[model samples]
Target: MKKRSLLFGLMATLVLSFASSAVADTKRVLILQSYHAEYPWVTDVNQGIRDALEEERFTEGDNLTLTTFYMDTKRHTDDAWKQAKAREALALIKSLSPDVIVASDDNAQSLVVRYLKDTSWPVVFTGVNADPRDYGFLDSLEAPGHNVTGCLERERFQGSIRLLKRVIPDASRIAVISDNGPTSRPILRRIKTQATESNLNITGIKAASSFEEWKQFVREMQTRADALVVVTYHVVTNEKGEEVPPGEVLRWTLENNRLPEVGFWKWAVEDGLLLSEAISGFQQGYHAGTLAAFILDGQAPREFAVTTPQRGERCINLSRAEALGIAIPRDLQTVTTLFKTQRVVK
Candidate 1:
């Protein structure tokens, strides 16, 4: 009886050892999203990350654990609020002690990855519009030369401009309109450069932070510019000087604006813009997730190169085109995703 009892005890010890080993092998990933959870752009990017993680057989609560933090920076634009939220995010990161960190968008990169660069934990970032060099995150696109690597959200200005030209053959002078937000600044610069190269005269570049200012600029552009290229309106304030929702801004712009409109995001087309050559936010997150997976699997972030999205979607709003008395080529109709209403596809 003594011998049998000892044998059972040994088996139990071995089982516990194996269970502990399994737990130790599990990887923990923390995702830092710079926008609200309800934001479609944020949700789409999160979905892409989830899909990529699933592809690697990383199931949550089993062999992989995933945690997410949404900074809600889009709604709260004040410097003090942002600083406080940054501190909160940093504290959370310290407590979690994640194995890998995946940051999404410019705010995350600026707020979280900026402080944690070259640390023990690896970081992969996506949806950054500003040049990575601007933040000293990498030596070059080819090699990060640090413990950070991921995809850059290249401005789709040229493609969208080309599409706009195709649809509006007589459009000579164009005006670029965007809110005076951090994300739009880099993109607006790129658009100005591309506009000059494309030989399309830039009549005006209006960066407005309030509804009245945006309306005034749009009214001016309607009379002078042949077409309007809307970048983003997330930071625009309403009449009361309070922050307004992007959807409301788009709705107002669609109802009031007269010029043929084009933009870089697919959702813009659904939101009343006439055409777009959209960069996929989902693919950006997927690439970032791919980098995170590599780091979790024992590969250094420096081993992987920074990437730019290879695919773009041609999106057109047929109803908006018709409303503006513009004609879309038959070939474009055959190849592009056409929407008749303001309903956006996720």
Candidate 2:
């Protein structure tokens, strides 16, 4: 009987120790994505998040648990439908109640702000371009007067322009395409300002309101412009009237029309763009993950300086370069962050 009592005590002690160890070894973090399926641009963002988490000394499995939720908007046809996805996403988020919620884009950020206005959970947004004041997410960018902050992908515009200038020197007439809705206006205005200051002759094309319209718009623009530039658009509707794949449209334009196109996301570079520049989505994700780790460590979101895409040039598709008969200058070559189709063997 004494031996059995000793065994019971030993077992209880071991169980308690194991439980304590388990609790200490696990950290839970929730990553909320605006889309479930992978698109090239944001996939890098997820990769960045993973890379950052992995580099951290205290990460999942060793003191962390990463829970990622990707909202799927492929079937939604309109903004209302997209918001419906947001609502559904909110329901899911309420259930998860994670330690942190990483908003992957403006859409996800909107949903989080609208749904969790009073919640104290930390939210780190990546790839958003909306004015914080407009969404009530913050008082201002200079001082994010709320519990939200991360990185924005908007500032990569200049890098894109510089690279395009390298690839298409004679590109005085550029064709700019965008969906005509909530987000496009600001992006267009910025691009327009840049074009005017840079002496870039740009012809802006608003994408069609419906999927059919978008298709026709692309067909029409094939012969109208020297090169193509895509900007954020929220007005173009999918069949479900909720969301349209802007990247896909950009891709189709490149593959079918055989023209040089440039995008802000490397994944959106497509095969035919003479050159493209974008902040690494994965890099953005890493910034977010690191910021999230800070919050997990009990630091306030506002304590960290709001970050933007690190300045760098990543280029792609030199095959597209050759096909377009555009000579890539050495100066631009010196700054390129990526080259998709060829190796710089020097």
Top-lDDT candidate index: 1
Worst 10-residue lDDT window, candidate 1:
337-346
Regions more than 4 Å wrong, model 1:
1-7, 344-346
Residue-by-residue lDDT tens digits, candidate 2, 1-346: 9999999999999999999998865666777777654555557777778778677665666777777776654334356868777777777667766777778876677666555654767778887666655667665677776687778767466677766666666666777777765445667777878888877777656645676676676667677777778664334676776555554654455556555777665654443355667657777788888888778778777776566767545666667667666667767667665454632110
Give each model a TM-score: 0.93, 0.82
lDDT of 1 by residue, 15-116 (tens): 999999999999899999998887767887888888788777777888998999988899898888888888988998899889998899999888778888
lDDT score for candidate 2 against the true structure? 0.67
Cα distance off (Å), candidate 2, residue 75:
4.8
